[model samples]
Target: MTQYPHSPENPMCQHQPVCPSAEATDREAARIIACFPEQGWSLLCNGVIVFEDTGELLPDGSSIAPHRGPARHALAA
Candidate 1:
């Protein structure tokens, strides 16, 4: 079995209020431990890697596809 980087008992967050867990829906809110804008990716404290396009790779090696919100259209007068 593959070993995940983060777990409930070993959450890697060190922030004051504590960031969300890797299993949480809001896991992307975790603090960024490392970032590489040139590579278009960032590593979060909860052991997740997020990309510039909003795609994600969870600690367990599962992937979350890019989830950008719909673009806003200007209101017609």
Candidate 2:
């Protein structure tokens, strides 16, 4: 498995406000911190914040992008 940098050594959040998720990872936590206004919505850790959420960044970010599928036709032949 790909070892992410932000994987917590201990099963606890190392930030001011404790994180409830035990499954949280290092990169994942950093991404979430980036969204914090006080934190300037960006954690420039070992990984780069290519995006505020998802894509080049980690899988799950602050807000998830909606699915983009083909539009359905109202008038059927």
Candidate 3:
């Protein structure tokens, strides 16, 4: 696993409302510190890499599988 210069308990986010910690359930909501549209992924302030498909790579090297909710079906007339 890769080690980050800052730990989750001591993140170095500068946002008005600091980003969520990598271990938080809503960690994916952290601000995007870096993005690579061509690569379909972005790095969050909390040290997580989120893919366009909703999958994630946490700072500790554990992966969170894509968790997109079920598609909504259209109502029949």
Residue lDDT tens for model 3, 1-77: 54445544637665656678888888987889899999999999888999999999998999999988765663332
Better of 1 and 3 by lDDT: 1
Provide TM-scores for the models: 0.76, 0.21, 0.75
Tens digits of per-residue lDDT, candidate 1, 1-77, equal 54444445437865657788888888888899999999999999989999999999988999999998875653332
Candidate number that wins on lDDT, 2 or 3: 3
**Number of residue pairs clashing in candidate 2, backbone atoms closer than 3 angstroms, sequence gap of 3 or more or interchain:** 4
Question: What are the candidates' C-alpha RMSDs?
Answer: 6.8, 10.8, 6.2
Cα-lDDT of candidate 3 = 0.82
What lDDT score belongs to each candidate, Candidate 1 first?
A: 0.83, 0.37, 0.82
Which runs of model 3 end up more than 4 angstroms from their true locations?
Answer: 1-10, 71-77
Q: Please tell me which predicted candidate would have the highest TM-score against the true structure.
A: 1
Preferred candidate (lDDT higher): 1 or 2 = 1
Model 2 stretches with alpha carbons more than 4 Å out: 1-31, 36-41, 44-53, 58-77
Clash pairs for candidate 3: none
